[model samples]
Target: MQKQDTGKKLTVSLIVLALTVLAAIITRLTGLETTSAKLIGSFAAVFLLTGVVWRFPFRFYCMAFGFEVLAAVLGSALNLYHYLGFYDKFVHYTSGIVLAEGGLILIHALAGRRHTPAEPLLCRLFSMFFAIAGAGIWEIYEFTADNLLGINMQGDNTNTMGDIISGTLGALTWFGIHTLMHKRQQEKQ
Candidate 1:
């Protein structure tokens, strides 16, 4: 019975994931803006994965609700009107991608260290490396948009570096805080 239930859940999840992917493709192609497309995609992945995994309420909380909120908030940090610059009208999509990738690591740190929700400082630093690397790629994409695609992201090399710095700061801060909070809770218990 348990196996059958899991199978059914998996099937449903696949269907939902397909639908979500479809929506993302459509949005991206229709020129709905890249950042929006990314958030939509992230939401779909988290909700679908959580539903299919059949995790307990706590896991679901960490994976779906917590991660989604964190990703969105971190992503918004870079989209402020000031960063938008004049020509781009304050709309560039690469920031969201950088932030989303960082958020993913943060999610991993939370659930990845299930044995001790509080991973060591080294682990957090290690994850920060990946986050920073992903941010580098994101900057490249932004550069492509500005130079090749003629989108004028207003994010030249300096802007790209700034984005990377902010992304690293965001990821490291989130992870460090999470680890500290988790350890504190454990102590109380």
Candidate 2:
């Protein structure tokens, strides 16, 4: 049953990724240079990361992979960030949650499945740290692109700070929910 579920998830993730790539191609063919560049860059990065994550032995990686691809498609190809003022914040926040989940999976996998929900503090901390680090690295990427490629990824310090804060909050929210869920499950068990 678990293997079947994992296969379904992987299939869905791959489909989403394919759609994202198609969006990038369409944009490029349409001569939307800026949007096409953004889409292609985001798609490439996610594709590479997904390739690495594929080697991992956890189902959560599929969830994170799908979310990241969808976020990139919405932001770059669909222009959600420009059309909806809050879309960027939404993406950043969800990204934090996804990253945190990935971190927790990594910790569990590295620990050889010895860790349990009963002892989750370390995993939670690692998740939060991972999310924050991801946000910081993303900011650096934005800054670099804005300066070197003249892209308006960062816009300004204010936007950068806001994005970081939003991401952190998202991580916190996910941690809280995860803890509660685990606690409930433990009680039931």
Candidate 3:
């Protein structure tokens, strides 16, 4: 692949680094509550991860990093806002995250390289495998974060199932998206 003028990459990474540092400074100065601190910390992680993409353009990593940063920012916002008496509850956060994560996983899977691996049926299977596996690994991370850190990410068992199901739906959504993109690509040829 031709080397991209990743001065933009460096610039973006620097912006994230600055944001991470700024979040640290603002939190220290404001002396916010526990939730606020956690949220800021989440953003810090997001920025730091994004800042590292200067090394390579691995599509999965890039998408994962970007999605995760967004997830942290929005997730932390949900916790802080709801607890600060803005919303009635924090449950909405989990659902929104599940949907969003699923979408990200699908986008990631579709964007990845597809080597003509097998027959049409097998190709479909392989495609689904990557999408499902990617989404499932993310869910596994959520489980680990919940069980190990006491975060109640899944909420209820039923809700957890729903989230998993929704994630699969998100993968399906990506299939549609990728199909359209592939069609456009073929048309250009």
Candidate 4:
């Protein structure tokens, strides 16, 4: 990464760290123990992942981090999921986009290390499947949480199917945009 870019990321990370601390303080003060713990853990995970994965695209990292804070922090802390029926699905859908982009970045990074440019088709296929698999994994996690902990995470079959479909559509959205961008580049060449 460029020096300027690194500086920008550092700034963003610091801001997030501050937010995490503030959230912890506020939630604890308000007697929201669960929310406080969740926010701290979620922010920590995002911070560590982004910090460790230095090769990830800056834009993608920002988007991923933003969505996480939005979904995990704002959404949970504000009780958006309970109030807004669409919010949960929206989060799942956006998660698919983030996962797809993460997969693409991972493939590209590996190919770069091997000194071979990844084929476009392979990248697209990997990204799409990765996102779908991620969606499945998320649903499984919800199911496990519900069963093991007796939590109301996964509402029902309808909700699970809807989340998966939303995620698939999100992946398709990214795929379409990527294909169009690649086509434009090919045409220019």
Best by TM-score: 4
Ranking the candidates on TM-score from highest down gives 4, 2, 3, 1
lDDT (Cα, tens digit) per residue for candidate 3, span 57-131:
445344544454444543353334334542212322333333343444444445465543334333443455455
lDDT minimum window of 10 residues, candidate 3: 86-95
Consecutive 10-residue window with the lowest summed lDDT within model 1: 87-96
TM-score for all models, in order of appearance: 0.42, 0.78, 0.57, 0.83
Cα distance off (Å), candidate 1, residue 123: 2.9
Per residue, candidate 2 scores C-alpha lDDT tens digits across 1-189 of 357666865675577778787777766676543455677667785667666666554556666666666577767776667778898888889888888887887777767666544348888888888888899899999999899998688977889999998889888988899889879988999
Which ten residues in a row are the worst by lDDT in model 2?
28-37
For candidate 2, the TM-score is: 0.78
**Clash pairs for candidate 4:** none
Writing each residue's lDDT as its tens digit, candidate 1 over 1-189 gives 256655655555555455445545655576543476455655565566555445433333333333333333223222223333431221222333334444545656577768556445555555556666766776777777788878865456676666667666655665666579768988999
Clashes in model 3: which pairs? none
lDDT of 4 by residue, 78-105 (tens): 4567768899889888888988898898
Best by lDDT: 4
Q: Which structure is stronger by TM-score: 1 or 4?
A: 4
